[model samples]
Structure formats: C-alpha cells, structure tokens
Target: MTDVHRAIGTHGFERLLHHLVQLRASQINRCAYCIKMHTQEARRDGETPERLDRLIVWEQVDDFSEREKAALAWTEALTVLDGKADLGALRARLRAHFTDQEIGVLTSIVAMINLWNRIQVSRH
Candidate 1:
C-alpha cells in the first residue's frame, strides 16, 4: 500500500490531499495511531492547522475546496460502508472532480487506510 501511494504520489496525486484523505478515513475509523501519524504527516506536508482541526466536519466548513470536499465525502462513504450510504451518488461526486485513474487511486488510499485502521484498533 505504501508502494501504491508512492507510485500515485509520483503520478501527480498531491501529497497534502493524500494526507487529508488518510486523516479523514482514520478519523472515521477511530484509529488513534493513524490519526496521530497522518496529522503529523499532514502538518509536515504544510497542511493548515485549521483545516486539519475541521477535517471531520469538512462538509459543514467553508475552508475546503470543491475537490477536497468531494474527496472527503468519498472517503467517508467508503470508510463507513453502512447500508444507508449512497455509493452511486458518492462516485458521481468523486467523478465531478477527479479522473477515473485518480478515483481508482483514491479508492485504494481509502481501502488501505481502513485496513490499517482495523489492524491498529484491534491490537489495542
């Protein structure tokens, strides 16, 4: 998964956005280790404190761009995967701002983070 992220990073997926996605998914999964790691990485990558603080409430905030919002929404939907989630609509939202390849990478990022989150959460 780190290799996948490295490859995607080389292919133009912004590092800040990648951290944001990982952070958001980690938050949803309640993985403290991931939250801490991603938050530090995001800060090191120059993400704003305010944005990181408000990430969990991204939908209600004005600090995020349309692209960031869309990505965050997609991350949440995939992380939760409850029966009530509207995956089709979420995919459409993601398509509005990201290419198919970008979407695939974003999906992988979310999936990988969720796997890590579960592993870390279960160990404690």
Candidate 2:
C-alpha cells in the first residue's frame, strides 16, 4: 500500500491531483489526522486556501476544472463505497478527461488512501 501510494504521487496526473484524491478520501473516511496531514501537504505544494476550503463542496464551485471535478466525482463515489453509484457514468466522465492508464492510477490512489484512512481511523 505504501509503495502504491508513492507510485501514485510519482506518476499519472499531477501531485496536486494526487493530493486532492487522497485528501478527499480521507475527508470522507473522517480521518482527522489524515485530513490535517493531507491538507498541509497540499498547501505546502501550493494548493490554495480556496481550493482546500472549497474541496468538500467542489461540485458546487467553479474553482476546480472539469478534469478535477471528474476526478473528485470518482474519488467521492469510491470513498463513499456507494454500491448503487452509476459506475458506467463515472467511468465515462473520467474517460473524457483521463486515459485508461490515468484512471487506473487514480483508482489505485483512492484505494490506497481509503486503506490508510481506515487504518488511521481504527486507531482511534
């Protein structure tokens, strides 16, 4: 899981996107430690206060691009573990902005973060 996390940041999409993905998943999982850690990491990497503040309400804002919004939709759906989510529609949205390889990387990032969030949350 750690290795996959490293790879996700190092490849496919930008580091900012990776941070957003991880942070969003962590937010959904209610991992306070992760939320703090990822928020700081993202800010250190130049993510704006506005973006971080608006992250939870990203769908209703214009601060993010279509590509980012697509990624966020995927992240939210996966983190929420919604069995009824229309995955086909999600994939189509993702495909509009990302390649298959990118989508795979994004998926891996979400999974790794969710695992980490679970571990972190379980400790408390």
Best by TM-score: 2
Q: Model 1 segments beyond 4 Å from truth? A: none
How high is the lDDT of residue 122 in model 2?
Answer: 96
TM-score of each: 0.93, 0.95
Among residues 3 or more apart in sequence or in different chains, the pairs in candidate 2 whose N, CA or C atoms overlap within 3 Å are none
How many clashes does each candidate structure show, in the order listed?
Answer: 0, 0
Local distance difference test, candidate 2: 0.91
Candidate 2 structure quality by residue, lDDT tens digits, 67-88: 9999999999998877899999
Give the TM-score (vs. native) of candidate 1: 0.93
Q: Each prediction's Cα lDDT score?
A: 0.90, 0.91
lDDT of 1 at 74: 89
Model 1 C-alpha RMSD vs. true structure (Å) is 1.3
What lDDT score goes with residue 32 in model 2?
Answer: 98
